[model samples]
Target: MSATQMDMLWMAYGKAGAVGSIRHEDDLFHVVMSDRREIGAYPTLEIAKGALISHLKPGTDRPEFRRV
Candidate 1:
């Protein structure tokens, strides 16, 4: 895969909360909330994206998924 593709994948995985450290094997990423809640496992990147999208400010740099 190209560098761009790899970056996209990493972005997807990261958005899914699958890029952080965790103890669970099934976890994609460890999400630590401001409430001190650590969500270890999540479903898919799309789901995570949906959950986070609304909370993101308008001018924030969002991750764009593209075909490489």
Candidate 2:
């Protein structure tokens, strides 16, 4: 499917923790958790995505990223 500009960025909850998404809003991007908590604001979506992945474990319960 074609990616839309209005896509909602969010993360999936795993056994260890929830890997939230890098939200693009207000002309800015941020890595937010599922608990409605903002980790930090990143300049680009790549940066934010990298940050989230860094927090995830490399085991079976890996964090799932969603933008649909």
| Off by more than 4 A, model 2 | 1-7, 12-18, 57-62
The C-alpha local distance difference test score for the whole of candidate 1 amounts to 0.38
How do all models score by TM-score? 0.31, 0.55
Q: For model 2, what is the error of residue 14's alpha carbon versus the real structure, in angstroms, after optimal superposition?
A: 4.6
Tell me the lDDT of model 2 at 39: 76
Give the TM-score (vs. native) of candidate 1: 0.31
* Best prediction by lDDT: 2
Task: Give all candidate RMSDs, comma-separated.
Answer: 9.0, 4.5
